[model samples]
Target: MLKKGLYGIYKGVEFRITVDMDNNLKIMTDKKEKTDSTFEDTYQSGVYTKIVKPNELVDCVSVTPFGIIKGEKVQILQEKENKYQVATGALLVGSNLNLPRIDRDSWLGWVSKGEVKLFEEITPINPEDL
Candidate 1:
C-alpha cells in the first residue's frame, strides 16, 4: 500500500493516498459522508476541499510559511474539532513517472473548516476503462 502523502494507483484508480497517523496504515480515500452528518461524525479520510473565501490567507498551525488563497485545493487528512489537517499540492497520478518523493511542493497543516468548501466527490476509476 502507498504510504501517507504519496500518490499512486489503488485498484486501478489514482488517489493521493493518506493514512490515519494514529492508526496502522489505514488508507484514506476521497469519500464523503451523507449530508445529514456532522463533522465529527463524518469520515474525513481523503476528503478534498478548495479555498472559497476570496483573498483569504490561511495560517498554518506553526510558523507561517506562505499564504493559501482562493481556489487552491487541499485534501483533508484528518479532522479535529473545528480544524482540519489538510494537504495542498499538485496531483501526480497520471504523470506516467515513478512515484517521486512525497509532496515536494505540498503543504500539510491545520486549517479552519470555514476556509474551504467541498470541491468534488471522487469516484474510483473503473479498472476496465484503463
Candidate 2:
C-alpha cells in the first residue's frame, strides 16, 4: 500500500469503452444499499483498479540529478489488485487511481498512463542517483 501524502496517477488498459466493458466494470460497485429520501446512496460508484507508482513522490528538490523519473508520470504497474477485479471493475470504473491531475482524460490518455511491463520489478530511484 502507498504511504500517505504521496501523489498517485492512474494507469491501466485502454478499456475500449463499450457495453461489454461498461457492464463489467459496473459490477464492482456496491450501490445495493438504498440512500435516504433526501439524497440517495449514489456516492460509491465507478471504483476500480489504480496504478500508483506504488510509492510517494519525494519532496521537490532544486534539481534532479539524473535517471530518476522515466518521464513526467509515474505508475506502479504492479498487480496489487487482481486481474478479474481489473477487468470487471474496468467495466464499471473505466480507470483507476484518482491522483492529482489524473482525470478521465489523463486516465484514458496514453501519455498520462505508464507501462505495466516496466513496473513488474521497479525500485526506488533517488533524485541524486548516487
In terms of lDDT, the best-performing candidate is 1
Model 2 misplacement above 4 A: 1-74, 83-104, 108-115, 120-130
Least well predicted 10-residue stretch by lDDT in candidate 2: 83-92
TM-scores of the candidates are 0.32, 0.15
Q: State the TM-score for model 2.
A: 0.15
Question: How would you encode candidate 1's per-residue C-alpha lDDT over 1-130 as one tens digit per residue?
Answer: 1123333343343334333444322222444531113213234544542212211211211111222325564556666787666665655421221223356665566667676464433343222221
lDDT of 2 by residue, 1-130 (tens): 2211112121221211111233321111122232223222234453333211212224312221111123322333323332111111121233333323344433322222223223222233332232
Q: Which stretches of candidate 1 lie over 4 Å from their true place?
A: 1-69, 90-103, 124-130
RMSD of 1: 17.0
Q: How does candidate 2 score on lDDT?
A: 0.25
Cα lDDT, all candidates:
0.39, 0.25
Q: After TM-score superposition, what is the CA distance of residue 84 in candidate 1 from its true location, in Å?
A: 1.2
